[model samples]
Target: MLVTEKSPIVIVGCADDNYSMPLATTMSSVIANVSSQRQVVICIIADKITQANKNKILKSLKKPNVIIEWLIPDYAKLTNAIISRHITIASYYRILIPELLPEKYQKAIYLDSDVIVKANIEKLWDTEIADNYVLAVRDMDIDATYVSSSKGLQNYQQLGIAPDCKYFNGGVLVINVEKWRRDNLSQEIINYISNNQQYIRWHDQDAMNAVIAGKWSELDPRWNSQAVIHSYSSWKETSLTEEMYNNVINDSYIVHFSSSAKPWKLGCKHPNRMLFFQYIDLTAWAGWRITFIRKLWLKVKDMMKKKGISFSQA
Candidate 1:
């Protein structure tokens, strides 16, 4: 069965003046595609959002199934603070809004801005978490257990996490909002980061991993197939083809772009990255014949102005 309010899928991202318009466009397109026949809510967390940005986002979103909201203390202050440059504050903005999310929505699927959702997100929303605290997928590259013992992770032992619990990635999370609030998980995550600011590498993800290390349920890797070397190397070496994607349509829920080679960036070899275009014409995101032409014009102008190259070019 297709996912609906009974199984709402929520996507979260942070944006500001500094954020890439393409990334937000991509996210909005993905949200619009997945929520076509169901109730889907896409929340963009930012210190403040501008009217211009709102119009751009709405224009890019081609599907009426998606609902976009700017999670802020007050919409009036959105013009004051820039979000992308302030990662920590952006994080706080996301953390602050769970209380405001519908009481009916006890759980949500949170994805980072860098991902490309290739399939119906409803499948992921429909996943049975059973009695797990929260559901998450482990990082394909960095073994949290190993990385935790490496340099800068000396605090791992102090946090009381079992050594074998495996440090998981927080980029894609199935959050149990009520449980998180009831257990004070968000506060614990914030406080833990505040207390140990120096030892962490990733900002909110690391702190969240520590807070819910052993507590979370291990989700299927396909739900969050990281795009790092380890995961990519494995995929490239396998004999898997488009047949795999076709056959596992229902079983495979999300295609997580959790590595350096994002679809928006150069040299993204992951097969699923191409799937993003199917939901929305990636090149036509800005309402042009081809996205690349618009991109080329922007790049040349930027280059003439001495602006650095973008990841899409590099």
Candidate 2:
């Protein structure tokens, strides 16, 4: 909250009404870990978020030396966007940061709503961009096998992406906003989203990988430690050895919940789910737990689906 002469560490997140609480959790965890010496400003690409939710976020994440700014973008083509119900219009808001943000910010970190910073954020913020379009960690969930076996390599080749390039998880990105502007990358991403739905499978994530393949640099996996239920199966999927993956998980600076099954929802089953609640308990929405009814309902649904027995048919 101190708007001093110190260069602020800019961080951004995208959220709608349902996601604001998780977004606040992400912000609070980061704010709690960041050293007081670091002047930070938090930016949210808010989409149809309620005033009540904004108040809740402020109440939860109130802190000095950190400023929260909201940007409500008019996505005039919202209806035209080929978006899945789960992936809201706000998800694409991140791709427009270079143009949407003030020209003063040369760089910033874009985090997803379902992540929490465990270690000091300056470890990520102060990292050198290495002159790439963006700096990101290799997706732990997106394995070499999937990339090689699925239509992934074919799709990348079709889209002119290099075959040898890595597919990054878009949960955390150290964006070079100045370079994005200089190269007119925002417009390019917008155009890709508008006209290239056939090629984009993971919404803007696929678009980003395709648009800037081999143009981005890698960071330590500890920076964006993803996967909700990581195990030996997860290690088999990635390029990492068992020992290496364990080190990454143990030393993760940012813990990212990248899957659709979130910590707040009933029957999440992930070990990291409670980690999300640790920060949420600190928020205005404390004592909020998943209802037993919801848990029982989800269990029944999962059982029926696994057994291939629909309720209607039964």
Candidate 3:
């Protein structure tokens, strides 16, 4: 393929051994949707990812115009980063992308492993970043008001952040690598996470929001339709209007499975769960299936639905 002279779309993703499949699935979705004219460079910040899984990821993304770069992060610096049952220390590796990637690349798009791209990413790459630190979608689940939810910034008052400031989801970030490097934002966010460990609920995401509040531009919600948008009650809780909600639900460019009930899991009811599986089937983990228990449960649910009996997991 003859690539264009335009700057290659640089994408950065982080993963460990457990997340290798999801990362590969994310890369596969990007490669599948991206235009052939543009060159895409995918940088995987690896943390103890096995050779076999790396091979699987490579096999999943077999595009002529797409180049892959494997980066080893400085784990020593990330040792103290907090992690939950589902998230790993690797989630903190995105903070290092500005310093780790080659200087020639001034900007990059960072996507979490638990997402699927449904449109040509070149459009997102072309967003006018100007002087902003990052372009991200407003987190639909977290309330901007400090008193509304504990999930919101716990120390917003202490951090001097406004009570009504918008909080962005770190899952999809259009980062201005040049600005991040110049301002030393990476270390600053790290320090915030360290100092506010007791108050930090969402780890790097909370730190980024605190350190870069009001600095990031908001992208269209369709670019990152989070799991919360699937339900009417949850979507209504967000600031999204009815028209905006309809647009995002009907035509999401990227479907982010940001909730704990992931598509790969047995009882996930996200509207895009099947869409996620479609991309997974295209990957090296083709024909991957949920356990027999899950399959049986699905059958039972289908039978109940046929009898007009609604089923909901408690």
Candidate 4:
């Protein structure tokens, strides 16, 4: 059943100016794909984004059904919280959704800046979390289980999580805002992260997994098709099956460029990177192309490297 809501569909995201264009590109796809009849509400956690960039987002989003709200939250409290390198504090804002949004919004869909929507956002918004805390997709390379003490369960055990507890990828989430606030999950997550700094490898993701392990509902693999090495190249893993890959390449609703091989950069092998560019064309960044000389140079360099030629030798 296609989930329909009487209330405005709440879509949440966070990003700095560095990703403003991509965020706009993502929002463009979202508004374009969502049903015209549905009222859309967008809330963004801004991280020092410029007024010019903000105007670009407003101009680019031109959809009549969408309403935009911006929030600038102080992240000073999270200074002691575990944070991974290269990941910004904006990425951590999703955890505070319950407190961040109005009371009317008892739930919200959190999307990462690095993703593009290909299907209706209502389908995700209307999904029934049932008895779970959140709805999310499983990771292609990372196992759900903590497995064992000597293995991947170090943080899991410290958090008193079972050996077989499921760990979800935090990129996309169907958050139960009421449940989060009711249970005071935000503070609990922060407390967990602060206490287990050594064990928190993925930082916010780990804290979320530890705090809400076995409590989230797993959505279909196609909803958040992460483009990992195993996904693109058939590297063997129990979590990522051949059938899953087929669904991702042929029928995914949202394609996530979750790894370092972002679609915007060169040498990315995700099958759906071009799909990202398709959305990019709709934004102000339209006609934007990776430099021809740079593209050719990268290819030539790749060919030379394959032939074992050193930089000086080349």
Q: Model 1: runs farther than 4 Å from truth?
A: 1-7, 20-23, 26-35, 73-94, 145-153, 229-252, 265-273, 276-284, 287-314
For residues 260-300, write the lDDT of model 1, one tens digit per residue: 55455445677677655553454334432335765576457
| 1 or 3, greater by TM-score | 3
Alpha carbon lDDT at 249, candidate 2: 65
Q: What is the lDDT of residue 174 in candidate 2?
A: 92
Query: Least accurate stretch of 10 residues (summed lDDT) in model 4?
Result: 144-153
* TM-scores of the candidates in the order shown: 0.72, 0.87, 0.89, 0.86
| Angstrom error at residue 224, model 4 | 0.8
Model 3 residue 109 distance off true place after TM-score fit, in angstroms: 0.3
**Candidate 2 Cα errors over 4 Å, as ranges:** 1-5, 77-80, 142-154, 228-231, 234-237, 293-314
Candidate 3 Cα errors over 4 Å, as ranges: 1-5, 142-149, 234-236, 291-314
lDDT of 2 by residue, 152-242 (tens): 4337656755566787788999998889889998777778777776666677777787778788988888888776327546566666777
114-232 per-residue lDDT for model 4 (tens digits): 89899987888878887678999876555443434242436565557777665677888998887888899988888887887877677688778878888998898788877663353
On TM-score, the stronger of 3 and 4 is 3
Candidate 1, position 106, lDDT: 72
Q: Which of candidates 1 and 4 reaches a greater lDDT?
A: 4
Ranking by TM-score: 3, 2, 4, 1
- The pairs that clash in candidate 3 are none
RMSD after Cα superposition, model 2: 5.4
Native-vs-model 4 lDDT? 0.76
